[model samples]
Target chain A: MQLQAEEYELQFSILVKRLGSWLSGQTGVAKAYVTLRDSQLLFLVVTKSTKYDSDFEDALSDLDIELANDPDLRDITLSVLSIPNVPSDSLSSFMHPTTNFEIQRGGNDG
Target chain B: MAETTVKDRLRLVERNHDALVALIEDARNPHDEWVATIAFYKAIQLVEALLAKRHGSVSTSHFRRLERLRVHHKDIYKQFRPLYNASMVARYLCLPDEPGSTSVAYFSSFSDYIGDAKAAIINGRLIQLEALVEKGLGEPFTKTRV
Candidate 1:
């Protein structure tokens, strides 16, 4: 499933290059990070906590999409609810970055 | 023949993870951090497989165990810098399937990526994760849609 063939995630910075306006439109947070592994795309969407819920609510409202739990998340379903509660230090324990992938060198502490 | 169920795989992984945890707790002579890194990810894929398969048999307790495991693993992966230089996305997820998407350029091949750096091994294996994530990135992924 890893798309080593084309290196799409590596090109994700290209998304920033080309889709910044589109992204800012979708997320008023003004900060987002997208990474890919093989075929799996890891989208790290961040916003101020104040902005976080509002933006998410707004985005879904505009799209008229219902936010319900389903199979697409059938695998990662557990951690989905747990993320908001993630404390700063526990972030380090994952053996991965604290949150989403960083868009810049020093963004996410990893 | 006794074929392995995703549940069986999960149990094996839990066993292996516990074994590694014991090694970490050893008092006499602690192994280098790299040894633990391998153990962490080896255990990761087993859980990844169960989650990926979406086994019907997984229970609330199972999810709880998995959650504890994932958060801790996330903490461990955060410890190192990429052996090579590259751009990546910040961490955030819109939904359950989307485990925070971002692009990263590192060792494309596991073996070649590590160089002589002992710590680089983990980055090497992270190379395979894309296979898992790409499956859930977009509209096809938004769990509720299904």
Candidate 2:
């Protein structure tokens, strides 16, 4: 069922946190961030391993049934982002500087 | 509907690669952050082509594209995540306060803000993808029941 924009974000964030917690129990998963953007569902994960082999495929596909059955999320396009274990000190390094710059750029575009 | 031939798919891969190259060339112009954002998206398309060739299907959904990438092509996924984040930054998401607000002047200085290190990371991703494409998508695997 569809929800208001605010409600959707709240529900989606809750779903993401729950899914993230469940995924953390699986081997090799460091973290998972479930988010919806532009009508697509994104599963951005950080992992202990960088391999997307048969084993990892199994882990991802295992979610299909659960995700497909969910009333709020089943209809959207789903995507994933898997990254290797990055040191905590370097975590912020993953974000684009321009993104931050753009936000802080503010009314100073002149 | 007639199934798309391998030749046709390969042609699409070539097109994606060509577009990526063009975006890279465009990124060399001034206002690089703006250009780099576009380049990152083209890079995603290029990876999608590679993944499509491997998987025998294509998706218009970004999430599905990334999901399959992580499931099937881990190597590319490693190179792609940061680029994807960078693209998100370029397009929207990961902002300090206001979102989706971008300007050349603001991001022009971003090159200096990131200095050489982060720039290297961004350029490094493109290089890795280019190398992968030059290597070509290898033989497709036949599925077998586990």
Candidate 3:
């Protein structure tokens, strides 16, 4: 069966919501939101507690659910196979998002 | 800290386009190392995030590469589908919680942004590679001519 990019994206989106919520519930992430960018999908599982990142991933693994990249399932699996740049502490998490407010990368839109 | 100029970024994009394509190929291939595969997706996400930050969105050719990859390798990339859309995932790590704070709140937040930026760049490169592969060299390119 051939699936279009958006089709894959839709399935992936549903999965993230189901899996992210499940993971959040298990890990105590009160408000977990899932977002899909093009075909790439991401689960922004938020919580009042900072340590929930690790727990969320762990819970996802525990459930044996993995994030998918539209058609690149293996790559998607690989993306999740490792520990993302999750913050271990507040201090480290503080420096997580770089201040690229006005600064742009590549410097070109075209 | 790219350690290079705009010209260098372009060169790097051109020189390494093939590698990025291959990375996605390997990532989509299940026979490859599981750990490496995940890293490839992570890396792509990082570059895409970066490119998106700079350009508001990835280019036409870049988006095409995404289409081709998705068409050929659905299962492999399925695990990272959310990161592709990545609306909320990035926010988990980045984004300012407080309204008025100029600086990001946490170190990890910065890390996520930088890492994601890298992913955006790499992901964007996938399309550039496709252009190079489909079209002959020395052709008129969108970002730069080959």
Candidate 4:
């Protein structure tokens, strides 16, 4: 059950996607994007509204425990951030393929 | 606003690096958690600036930014992962019931607590990242543009 670094990353990515989809099905959640950096788990959960209801907190608590039990993700810090749901158009734009652009002022343009 | 060029991102990298140095010094004086908080952000901003130079765009989402680095520049990603983890812990993971007040006792036992040596290491990584970005930018723009 020893996983290499790449293996861990791949497994975690799949796990995050599945978890996100499931979380989105819940009452308050609209969409979810999960990331594990250095094995620390962070869920960027898009919510139907800004306020976090009790049901949402309960679900997040359960999700946290579930992620902790996974062999590959155990012992890592787990947290969630709730953000307003994004428009479909904007999400689609974000998914578009990246294009090369001329570097403009303040290479920090991003 | 016009698009940011590699030159602009390079300048940002330098600015964040300078800020990080100052924060490290400030942290030594009062051991304030806010110092670590600002330092963490500076570290992230510095790395993002370097990534913008390479990819021609940088992600706004922290995770996405790291993912891009992992995909395109594994070497840089490896160096950055720990810094990101430390910063996350400093900012989001460990906290007191009160706002703006950090419990030193709580922080001492926090799993991802960033010690002085770790802070130094993060600074060192920023230096390396800056050098790498500058070298990459030195190449012909047409060849590096992607």
Per-model root-mean-square deviation over C-alphas: 17.4, 12.7, 16.2, 16.9
Q: Score every model by TM-score.
A: 0.26, 0.45, 0.28, 0.44
Weakest ten-residue segment in model 3 chain B by summed lDDT: B137-146
Stretches of candidate 4 off by over 4 Å are A1-110, B1-3, B27-39, B95-112, B117-120, B139-146
Model 3 chain A lDDT-worst window of ten: A99-108
The positional error of residue A103 in candidate 2, measured at the CA in angstroms, is 22
Cα displacement (Å) at residue B133, model 3? 32
Which candidate's DockQ is highest? 2
Candidate 4: residue A38 lDDT (0-100) = 38
Say which docking band candidate 2 falls in: incorrect
Please estimate how well model 4 matches the true structure, expressed as its whole-model Cα lDDT: 0.46
CAPRI rating of model 3 = incorrect
Candidate 3, residues B1-146, lDDT tens digits: the string is: 32223333344445444443454455444221222233344434434333343434442554443443344434322333333333233333342343343332333432343243323333433244334323322222233121
Descending-lDDT candidate ranking: 2, 4, 3, 1
Q: What value of lDDT does candidate 2 attain over all alpha carbons? A: 0.48
lDDT of residue B29 for candidate 2: 55
lDDT of 2 by residue, B32-126 (tens): 35544644655665665565566667666766666566556666665665566545433432223332343311222334432442244345565
Q: What is the lDDT of residue B136 in candidate 2?
A: 53
True contacts kept of 1: 0.00
* Per-residue lDDT of candidate 1, residues B1-146 (tens digit): 11234546546555654555564456674442433343444435444444445433332453343343344333222221121111011122122232343342221222222232223322232233322332422111111000
* Candidate closest to the true structure, highest TM-score: 2
Task: Look at candidate 2 and give me any clashing residue pairs.
Answer: A78-B63, A78-B64, A79-B63, A80-B67
